[model samples]
Structure formats: C-alpha cells, structure tokens
Target: MIRTPASRRHGFSLVELMVSVVIGLLALLFALRMVGGAEQTRRSALGGSDEMQNGMVALFSLGNDARSAGYGLNDPIIAGCNTQFSDTKGYQLAPATRGTTDVTPLAPVVIEAHGANPDRVTFYAGTSIGGTPTLRLTSDAAAGATQFDVDRIVYGFNQGDVLVVAPEQPGGDCLLVQRSDSDPTATRVTVAADAGMRFNGGTPTATFKGYAARVFDLGPVGSLAFRSWSVADGYLQLQATGPDDASAQPSTVAEDIVSIKAQYGFDTRTGSAFQPQNGLQVNQWSAAMIDADGSGTAGDAADWQHIAAVRLAVVARSKAVERPAAGAACTTTTAQPVVFADAAPVGVAAVPTTVNVAVTGDPVDWRCYRYRAFETVVTLRNAGWRPNP
Candidate 1:
C-alpha cells in the first residue's frame, strides 16, 4: 500500500479536521457537566440525612431525660426556693428540678424577659423504681453493715453510686450512703465512712426483706447529676455538674441546631365537672404566686406538681450550602418564621408563655440551605403518677 507523498491522497481539508475536533470537545464537555451535577446532588442528600439524624438523636435524649425527671424524690415538682427537706424534689431531696434562666433560675414569671433565653434544667433520679430492683441489700438491717451484699448488679454498680436503703414496710427508717469499694462482681459493696445512718429520720432495724436499697448514678462518682442543655456556636450541647463538682462543662450533642423552644403542659383539670375536654393545659406561671422565703407558697410548689408534659421544638440546618434555581422563592429573613416578641406587654397579668431560644450574632440566609424541625410532646411519667397537690 506504499504510495508517493503527493499521491498519498490529500488527508483532509484543514477546516474539516477543525470541525471534527470541535464536535469531540463538545461531547466531552457534556459528560463533565453531567458528572458535576450528580456529585452536587449526592452531597446535598448526604447533608440533609446528617441533619435529620442529628435532630432525632437530640430529641430522643431530651425526651428520655424529661420522662425520668423527679424520679425517686418525695415530690415530683419542687419550687425553686422551697428548701423543705420533705417537699424537696429530687433523689437527694434538694430543689431537684429547676427551670432557670441562662443567668439564674427564674420562676415561670420572668422566663420571657430576656430576648434570647436558654434554660438550664437540673434534676436527679434513681436507677429504677417501677422495674425489678437491680441492687438490693442481701444482709439484714440493724444499726449498719460494714459492706452491702447486693442481690445483683445489672450494669456493674460502680463505686460512688448513691445508695438509698428504704424499708419495705411504711414507717421504717432508711439510709443514704455512697458506695466506696470498686467491685463489679455483683456481690459486696463498701460504703463511705461518712454515710448517713438515719434515712428518713430513722435508723434501719429491719431485715433484707424488710428494707430494700437502690443506687443513683449521676455520671461521676459520688455526685448527683445537674444536667443541662443549651445552644452555643450553632451546636446543641449537653452539660452536667457532678454532685462533687460545682460547674458543668458542655459537650456538643448535635451540630447546626439553631434554636430550641419548649412549653409545659399542666394538669389543670380538677374535679370531673370543672375539667375541660383535655386534661392538660399550658402553664405560663402567670397564676403562680412567688414567695421570697423558701416557705410553702400556695401556687408555687402547688403548680409544679401539675406539670404533666413538655412540648419541645428544635430547628436544624444542613451542614452543606445549596443553591436554588433562579427566580425561586427561596428567601428567609429570620431564623424562624414565627415572630418572637422581645418585649412583653406592661402589666400583662398573664402572657402566654413561649419558651424558646433566639439565636443572634450572625444571621443565616436560611433559604440557601435545607432545614429540619423536630418536635415532640414528652409526658413526665413520674410527674403524671403523682396526684395534683
């Protein structure tokens, strides 16, 4: 097939070769565009998924804790100022549950005064009350046993678990002690040297069947938990103060949580005739009376016991930014659509309470990203079981 250069047949015209090259380039550009679009779509989907997962986890944790609030305490709800040992609400019998402001614990009345409000909820509970007792003393109660012979340890009762020994029969005395020896063998537990001998104003003289003991694990050893949730730097954080520790350090629970709002459900329906169709009503603390002294106020502790449920709402944003189509109605001025009143009306006898956190500092163009909202009404099981005071 050899031929002379001139006879090699003129390859093709320069213009024709240029046209072929241009077509090939166009096909390659089209394929590149498709790949880029697919990648962007994948990223958006993954971002939205992450946002949803975070929201669910946050809600679950908050709700679970709320249900167990005020467990094993004498009273389900205790007034912030009430120092009455009998009426104190918590496992340790202090003012167990308090809805305080970011600065100080506020009565329901002054919660909405601040423009951006975050609540610090502090409470404690025993390991279990309704279910089968996990840790019960195997020895009888007389004056005191050097070490506790527990029936079983469900989760490996660690050292420092607050132990409360209560008598099976009413009127018998109990004891509150902190476990000292670190033994996960589920048999014997050593008690602290300074453990209280008289529980509930009496000493234990009954046998193992006569008295039972339960442990309260407050995260760290030898401390009651003072757990709180707040938003900082666009992340929802959970913090706790050990019984021994005064301050709490927050750990991020979820990212991109912009705001949190809550409302309390009070069991206001008293007597069948006066009761509304719904047994629950929102409590704004407007009707609650305040007593500077920690005395037994009429409406303060009285109203706290009526708290039956809590409605919580939170808003989260996708981690990745998204671009909307041109001319799309994608614009949001504020973090949320609802209007948050910065100032309450003067002399307002009863303003509807709206427990919410307002995020300030940097405004986010919420329209540029995907958003998810999580809301649930959590029933306080312990509170519900208690009758209205």
Candidate 2:
C-alpha cells in the first residue's frame, strides 16, 4: 500500500463536531416544546368535555324529577301543609318553615335559598293513578291512632301505600303514614307500626290530630317521589325519602357540580277577591314566593300554587387545576360564573344571579378551574290539574 499524504486524508474538525452537537440539542428542544404544548391542549380539551358531561347530567336529572312534581299532590288542601312523617330507616325531610316558626307549607316544589351559596330544592309528588281524590275521614283520628275510618270503603289503596292525612285547611300540619293493611271493601285503613315497613315504626316528632281530615293517597310506598337536590363537596347530591331507595343517606348524582340556583316562575294574575287565577303565563320570577295576593304573608299556599314553572341553573367546574407561571396569577378562570344571564322572558320580571365557587380549606384556588353553566325552564304541567281548594 502506497503511503497517502496526511493533508489528503480529511476528517471532521473540532469546530464541525461542536456545531453538529449544537444542532442536535436545538432539535431536541423544539421537539420537547411541541410535546409540552400538545399535552396542555389535550388536558384542556378533556377538562372541558368532562365539565360539559357533568353539567348536562345534572340538568337532566333535576328536570326529570321536577316535571313529576305534584303528580298525586295536586290537592289544594294539602299543597302547602307542613307534613310530619316517621321513618325507621333514618330517613328525614327538611321541615317546611317560613321564618323561625314551623309554618312551612308543603308544596310540590320548595326552594331554600342560601344567598351566594348553592340552593337546595325539594320536590314532592305521588304515583297514585286515582288522581288525588280526597277520602274524607268520617271520624276524628286521635293522637297515636293507628287506623283511619273513612266515609267509604278504600278501593284503590294497597298495602304499603303512603297516605297524607291532611286537615281541611291548607296551612295545618299533616301526617304521612304507610298503610300496613289494605282491604278493598273495608271502611277502615290501618297504618300500624308493623314489621317490614320502614316508614311506619318510628315515633313522629309531633302528634297528629286529624279531625274532619282528608286522606290523600300517594300510591305505594316504593313509588312515592320525595327528593331533595343540593350541592355539597363539589358534587350534586340527592336525598330521597321514598322507600324504594336503597339508603336514606344522600347519594352523589354528579361530580364537579359547584353550585345550583333556582327560581320559581309565578303567575301573579288574580281574579275577584284576590284569588289566584292560576294562569299559564308566568309573570314573575323569584327565588322565594312573594305576597302575590297582598295577603301580608309570603310563601303561603296560594303563592306555592301559583308557581307555574321552575327555572334552574347548575354550574360545573373542571376537575384539573390549571397552574400559572411562577409568581403569576392563574388565567384559567377570571370571573365567577353567572346564571340567568339573559333578559327574562318577554313578560317575566327577574334579574341575573351570580354563583360563588370558593370553597373553604381547599388547597387550590377556585379561580384556577374552568366552569360551565347549564340552565333550563321546566313547566309544571301538573299545576294546571290541581284541584280547587
């Protein structure tokens, strides 16, 4: 082999090697930046999808229950009574009250306002197919009486049927009991605290004195719909008093629900003597019932009866907490969510409302999470079918 000149045998120089290493580092840095951006976009998309899903589910579930309100509770005499009940399975209902006193009238739907916090909405309905015909008590039912004597034989009632023993007046207290024995042609119905009946064994907080009372059938115990909806621990929860529920404790309906706001759509029109006309058109929207009849009292039975529809809004927050650059404030959420943002219906009077998302003792600020709001106006069809007082 002939010996070649060293100058002819060329190889990479140190400068060239350094330049190549620098180019490789630049490419890696660009790739890393692209990956980071893609990951952020993916996370945002996922968070938004999750929020939408949760909000829709919350709205649908609430609307479905609201539509069924007053199904078997359309009788005006018991529409706004403070109902008392006992359940051995730890089931309890929020008592109806106007102020500090126990003048809370039972209604198909009752909204408990909590200022800027989430509101609680309770719905009452029955599954009776008999259409809310009152069964008059032929005799007075004394306190602790287990049986009720009606004028005629109980035809549609069955064992385990829930009944509301209400006074003839609208504002009196009512008793809720489950029928322990059913006889088709019997004039007397028994509500004894028998075994296997969860709603009949516990002692009621108040004694029931039903004189000239009327019994409103709420269908079978398992079919009754007495549910309350509220938001707690960033979740939409439901507490059901119906015997069909597996547990008396509140169950989580959806996650990431931050707030719930509701308003009653009332038909304020009245006829002669200041009687409610029960019109179909809603004229006012309010969180609580107003004295529509100038009766000097708010949230009376007439006010509750005038509620033609319910307007609801629910806010859902993204699960991921977006972080900001070092020493900078988060830009993910700049303002609190709003409800009733648009102008009220053409003839309705109302104002917009804001929701508070801040939670105490939370490690991350609520502003770091994105939010979505779902809203709907549900007409209470059963309102039109309510029997006259």
Tens digits of per-residue lDDT for model 2, 61-160: 8999989987887677777777777777675665544534655456778888887899999888888888755688878677667888888888888888
Residue 211 displacement (Å), model 2: 7.5
What TM-score, to 2 decimals, does candidate 2 have?
0.92
* TM-scores for every predicted model: 0.55, 0.92
Candidate 2 ranges beyond 4 A from true positions: 1-10, 202-211, 243-246, 271-278
Number of the top candidate by lDDT?
A: 2
Best by TM-score: 2
lDDT by residue for model 1 (228-326), tens: 666766688765434432332567888877665555555554445222223444433221223312333433444454555555556676777676567
Candidate 1 clashes between residue pairs 3 or more apart in a chain or in different chains: none
Clashes of each: 0, 4
Q: How far is 320's C-alpha from truth in model 2 (Å)? A: 2.8
Tell me the alpha-carbon RMSD of every candidate. 11.1, 2.5
